[model samples]
Target: MKVLVTGAAGSIGRVVTPGLAERGHTVVGLDRVPQPDGEDGAWYTVDCTDPDAVAAVFDEESLDAVVHLAGHPDEASLPDSLSSHVVTTAALLDAVHEHGVTRFVYASSNHAVGRTPRTDLLTVATRPRPDTFYGVGKVAAEALLSLYADRYGLDAVACRIGSFLERPETLRQLATWLSHGDCVRMVEAALTAPAPGFTVLYGISANTRAWWDLEPGRALGFEPQDDAEAYADSVAPDAPEDVEVDCVGGPFTSTAYERPALDRSS
Candidate 1:
């Protein structure tokens, strides 16, 4: 299968490109920046927000599937930055429909369900209760995936991805950490799963204390091997004590809507 990965230069995409290539799939990496070392698969310079550019790439390459990973991942502080995210994702979905590409996997975030209280997280199904514009953009993308699946016959999966880091360093990471290997496996399952349509699954590993339920994803044959417990000792001491920080996915959802200002003293 030939897969087109948007935001190929991104942290997850950088690792994901190689992982897919190693699995015998051809990868076409699209990013705004050129690949510095070019060690990965074919890299194409692109801004996913541009409809013409995104469509041209799809028209040029007969993409078997699309792993949409490009977007503003953080929404807490940068409310003004999500216009690009919305435009890019909206364009990507449009291109997918135009090209008749059936398989689509969107990089939805745990932040998409950000407004849900921490206690209700375990049972509450995923809805568009976004806490920030970035999260709102993700929710929009998920809605597009659902609409496309239902109306246009496009098969899609939305992964409410937890942290793709190796370990949880901050308070929110305890509930959000998604190990590297686990992500690869989850993505692989999403790609190969049969009859997936508008499915939304959390991107957490098989941690002992997982906040979101993985039963629905289990039907997709997704069984995470890596566990966040490996980093328990290293990150446990840094855990937040109260609600302001504890287990609600941190400042990414809790922070005020203000861009990070430069420290003049620096």
Candidate 2:
């Protein structure tokens, strides 16, 4: 199948593009940044926020699927994040409808439910209680994906991606980390799921202590391999002695909106 991957130069896209190629799918990578030319697949300089540019690409390629990963991807960056999330999503969904694209795999965020208290019952059906403006935008995109799927018969799947980090070092990430291998599998499932309405799936690995649930995603045939629990011994044994909140999802929930920036590497 011919696949169009937006944000092809970004972190997940860099890994995911080659992964798709290895799976025997012809890939067309689109991004704002200039990447080295690829003979294995094509690359484009289209801006996903522009409806005309996005629509033109769709019209030119008889695309079988679209992995929509083009957007601002920062947690602390406020208005910019909101703008990037909302505009890019709107433009891409509109283009998908215009071009008769069959499947759309959108990159939503765990932050969409960031404000929800960490518990065993963190299902996909959980109502979005966003902790930041970025989270708000992700929730908004999820709604748009659902509406597009219902109205246009597009196969839209929203993956509420958790921390796609290498491994956990802090106490919070031990339960929220989504491994790279697991991310690839989840995206594959989103693209190839047989039955689709507006499915929302958590993008965490097979971690036993994860607060997010994966039963809703089981129907998509995604079975994660890596579990963050493997890093328990190497990571911090307890939450920071001075810190306040202490469930899996991290200080993100109880963090004062104006608190000093915690080092992302921590």
Candidate 3:
């Protein structure tokens, strides 16, 4: 597969690119910053929010799939995150559809449906309850992907990712960790699925502390390999009693909206 990966320098992209290349996919790594040295891909420095920037890449590379990970990763700045998450997603979807690209792997987040009770299973069928502006943008992207897929014959997958650190480090992560290995497998499944019209899957490891159901991811052939329980003893053992655990997004729901939300690292 000739894959165009957005945000290739981000933490998750750093984990995903090598594995995709190892699987023999020709990766076109796109990001605001340059893709790191030793990464096995053609790197392009481009802002994902710019349609021309995204379209220019499509014009140059005949792509088979797009793994979109470009976004400001927090609920801090509404305008900046919205620009990257919502506007960039729209641009990418249209560009791919226009260029006849077949598959799209959208990196959605658990925060999109963050207000859902953690006790209830969060299936793709569940209603979206965005906890913050950032989550709303992801939800918007999911809807945009769906519209394009249904109307324009693009195959798309929106993965509602959980905590995506090197490893689970906090009490909340025990139930929501998305290990790097599992992240790669999830994207591969999205790209290589035999028949993917439009799907939504949670992106997380096969952990015993998992709150969201994995049935949707299973149907997409995403076999997660890691379990957060392995690091349970090493991570923070207790959550602040005042911290709400009922919603899927945890503190994101309560975070005061602030400017500069879309920092470079996010």
Per-candidate TM-score against the hidden true structure: 0.89, 0.90, 0.93
**Better lDDT candidate (1, 3):** 3
Off by over 4 Å in 3: 239-241, 255-266
TM-score of 3: 0.93
Error of 1 at 121 (Å): 5.2
> Candidate 1's residue-wise lDDT over 1-266, tens digit each?
89999888889887778888888889999989898584755778998878999999998899889998887666433334455556777788899889888898888887777666677546426446776667777777777787889998888988888778867675466657788777877878888899787798888888765788887677788898776766677775545655435435446554554456322445
TM-score of 2: 0.90
Pairs that collide in candidate 2 are none
The best-first sequence of candidates by lDDT reads 3, 2, 1
lDDT of 2 by residue, 187-250 (tens): 8888888968789999888887777888767789888999999999897666543232343334
Q: Say which prediction, candidate 1 or candidate 3, comes out ahead on TM-score.
A: 3
Error of 1 at 168 (Å): 2.1
Clashes of each: 0, 0, 1
The residue-level lDDT of candidate 3 at 1 comes to 93
- Residue 2 lDDT in candidate 1: 91
Q: Candidate 1: where are CA atoms >4 Å away?
A: 76-82, 120-126, 236-241, 244-247, 258-266
